[model samples]
Target: MKMNRTLFLITLLSTFAMQGQDSLVSNIQEVTQVADTVKKVPQRYKVEGVAAVVGDYVVLDSDIDKGYLEFQQQGVSTEDITRCQLLGKLMEDKLYLHQAVQDSIVVGDAEINPEVDQLMQYLTAEIGSEEKLLAFYRKNTLPELRSELFEARKSLKLAGRMQAKVVENVEITPEEVREFFFAIPEDERPVFSAEVAVAQIVVEPEITKEAKQTAIDRLNEMRQDILENGVSFATKAGLYSEDGSKTRGGLIEGVKRNSQYVKEFKDQAFSLLEGEISEPFETQFGFHILKVDKIRGQEVDVRHILVYPEVPQSSIDAAREKIETVRKAIVDSTITFKNAAIQYSEEEDTRNNGGQLVNPVTYDTWFDLTKMDPELSAKVYNLKPGEVSKIFVERDRTGKASFKIYTVTDRKEEHPAEYVTDYERIKELALKEKQIRAIEDWQNKQIKETYVNVNEDYQECEFSSDWVKTSN
Candidate 1:
């Protein structure tokens, strides 16, 4: 399916405060338009017309018509959707943007620039290249598209900031959670699947001394080639750098001296004269050779080549054995699992949290079995509470191999959610609902107070909100 790139863009651009159902509804409105595929401008909408005016900003009919076509192209059924509803949404967005300006809410270039780059990357990849994308949009260059969308992007950020401000202090209590859970009809209550809470101790496979030296030697050779054999640093970086920016010839721009770069990297980079290449140096990731490209005050642009060392089979075996020992000690009760994790586990994310694995989806320790990693699920499927599994090797998302031991801390069979067993889940739901209500209330008041005007063309459309009645 050609994803509704426009809808995706709208959602990505706006950071609404109301989550769950309310957020979904707001998002739908934000992107709604006519029920037609966007192609060459239709004769009806070709004659430019005003849709609505909210405060200082005006919604153009062309905007809604374009969004409608883009929506249909994304495979969305706009059969029941209307232009009036779409215009209402556009006006709502403008209302938030107007208030944002009045309140001086600002989104800096640093924040928006990355989002723009990411969007460009996504569109370029989807359309098959920069050239294809430019042709599709009838533009000469990528920057032209960016410039055309810049205002829409700015308004999105502004509306997001305003929404965030409205619900910044909203919260829900335990009693409210209980009340909300009981209020749902019995058949409508959430049903939870079998879940497990597990803890783990992880040990990363280490790169051996020989492996480290080999990487350093390779980087040294590259540096020597650049400095003595007249090899271009950018060419060498493109050929050898392991970093993501290697595609851009290993070039890094707008780097500040005090940024989070490693001390060794920063010190060497700042000391180099423009166009000077550094001798190879080692950091946690690997060996690197850097060349200064430009300097402006405290910021310096540079290019680099990085080579990562491979962990050997012997290193993997050693790490596995080390974790096995820790698991044995825990099984023997020589030390508590939490204490052993704190003292010995190399995995930083879970070590301090007593090795407890939190579900990324729920942000809780309990995970639905179906949502767990298949290997992890198999290992713990039949384990009783407090039972520890044998040591196992697995690769993380980044493809880094590691050894780990799993302990089933708790388990619960599939059942309807109850007050005692699902208090946390209920509390989370209640809190989200409370926040949504707060946002709704705030939006209503803002709409009532804001100066809004709907054109006669859209005055007869049934809108969810009283936008037409409230418009001055």
Candidate 2:
């Protein structure tokens, strides 16, 4: 994504707006102490001076340091760009953030709370716990940190809206696409290789029998403690659950009723009443004893201790057999492909959707033979519509391999770009460019009126827009 500080500021503001005023101020004071509290940081990434200030907000020395460190981590070379490009991008954020407050954009509790939770989760993963994160940020607690970030979040969101407003309705015509295509240099014209869309019948690896037994034994031990020793399941989840949802006492958010989780995990979890414990059952993650915490209508919250079994050849052999059975069932007239998916597929994201791959570019439902990755598209190009290919190992964007079956439903090789093929996308792109121009124009005007003071240290630097007054 394009990096803009204006968006960052709005988001930061909105995030804090949800948090009460007094607490939010306290959080800012604490955040300012971030430099003071940094007893230890990554050795390679030393602090850099604060490059610029956007209005009242002081850009911190650590901000530039962290930015440099991340760029280095990502292997981005700064050899090509002059200091002008860097300053322009960095300082443009201040302009956007200032506009954000004037526009009165606010992000409320419903919006910020989830972000706070995600932030907490990330911090917990980074620093070991919420307490450590608080210490690192020089804050008293999570609530304090969240409150300070609320305003920033708002500032960021408003900046985005302003950007959208700048060119939201701009359109690119057929001529524009051709113009863009022709604008590419002959040497730089990228090879538009054939991409394919493939559907999947995924199967997870099976855990060892010994692993299952061990998990059962451990869960039984935990269950015994819960029953006899008065230990709470939530506490057990915090201490023992291996799933990412462990910290929230086994809470899983946004689960769909139509979706499928591991059958073993689901069957036992769904069967148990509230506050009841499930006997150990085996799933892809391994042997788990489930503690059913709450049921909200169609959803249930369960904390489970998953003890993964070391994979034995026999375990793979077993899992392969079970998945192949479903594959066979699909091949035969025994079950409709959709029915089999709904009944037997463990891949939750695509199970109810009938394992159909949706196009990210177009919201169109049909899988195209041409737009897929070279490796996948190569395999699926030969298959006819409605015919299912055999189980193939394909890596997702993350490079995780799982069992898959591709069914080609659509094949389009060439066409004059129509509204269906490219109009909306082209229009959206054009509109955004227009908006950016509009925003830049508006920003230029704003700078003329608004008091902008840059330290004389940057007088030689040619920013995107020149600052009005110089500060010592």
Best by TM-score: 1
Q: For each predicted model, how many residue pairs clash, with residues at least 3 apart or on different chains?
A: 1, 33
User: How would you encode candidate 1's per-residue C-alpha lDDT over 1-472 as one tens digit per residue?
Assistant: 1123233234322354222211122122212222224443343553568888888998888888766665564345656556665666677678788889889998654334434544555565556777877776679876688766555666667887787787689888778888899999988899888999999888988888898899889988988888889988889887888764565577777666666578888888899999998888887667888999998788888898888888898888888888888988999999988888899998888999889987755567887796565567898998888878888878642356888888888899989989887888788668766765676577688888888888887789767667889877
State candidate 1's TM-score. Answer: 0.63
Error of 2 at 55 (Å): 2.7
Question: What stretches of model 1 exceed 4 Å from their correct place?
Answer: 1-162, 173-195, 227-232, 256-278, 291-300, 320-344, 358-384, 388-393, 396-398, 412-424, 445-462, 466-472
What's the TM-score of every candidate structure? 0.63, 0.52
Superposed by TM-score, candidate 2 places the C-alpha of residue 167 at a distance from the truth, in angstroms, of: 4.7
Candidate 1: C-alpha RMSD after superposition = 7.9
Model 2 spans with C-alpha error above 4 angstroms: 1-48, 68-77, 101-162, 165-194, 204-237, 245-319, 325-354, 360-362, 365-402, 407-425, 446-451, 468-472
**What local distance difference test score does each model get?**
0.73, 0.57
- Residue 236 miss distance in model 1 (angstroms): 3.4
